[model samples]
Target: MELVTHSPGDGVYPPTGDYAHAIEVRGAERLVFLAGTMGLDPSGVPGATLDDQLVLIWSNIRVILASAGMTVDNIVRLTSYLRDASYAGANAKARVEALGGRVVPTTAIVAQTLDSEWLIEIEVTAAS
Candidate 1:
């Protein structure tokens, strides 16, 4: 699949982040909308800490994407919700690792609370 990424063309400096302002896919043959995924182990146990869960969540998303014959490079959009605002750094680090430097359109929100067990949840939209 061919994808086009856009940022401001206004000659201004862009923000420091791993995301593109927007992503465009032309005639994408397939699209997948994944539901919000949270971190959990193979035994279906939620991670004890935010950092651990971040890795697990991304891992699960990768598996799901692979199952659909897609990869993180095919992701056009990513939305992440965090239970605590301070986890932003960890979140960004994990996301960068997960995307492997691919720039995708992304939004991240911090909620006052999620379920007691989940530190983060992520939703994805991919095309290939």
Candidate 2:
């Protein structure tokens, strides 16, 4: 796989050391776009807190990535929907850490989620 990184001269640098300006992958044989995943456990129980939900969501994403014979590095984009926008930063930080510093995927965090009981939902797009 070929990856591209862009650093615009006029654009401001990223505050966090984790991500690049952008990532591009070309000549992909297959692409996967996963549905929004909630924080439900194996038995369909929701996590008690936002931190717990974040952890579970990350784990689920990891599992899905592995199923496709890919890793977090293969992800190109992510969309996260949160029950509360105020908690987005903290949740994103937890997700990045869970991925072990690989944060190339572009992310969007929305305040309004589909379910009231859910704290967060994450969708991903990957190629390999």
Q: Which pairs clash in the backbone of model 1?
A: none
Best by TM-score: 1
What digit string (tens of lDDT, one per residue) describes model 2 on residues 12-115? 86545655677778888988888998887888788898888887888888888899898777787777787777877877797678667776645656676766
Candidate 1 residue lDDT tens string, 13-47: 68566878888899998899999989988888999
**TM-score result, candidate 1:** 0.91
Residue pairs that clash (backbone atoms under 3 angstroms), model 2: none
- The stretch of ten residues in a row with the least summed lDDT in candidate 1 is 110-119
For each candidate in turn, the TM-score is 0.91, 0.84
Candidate 2's TM-score reads: 0.84
Off by over 4 Å in 2: 11-18
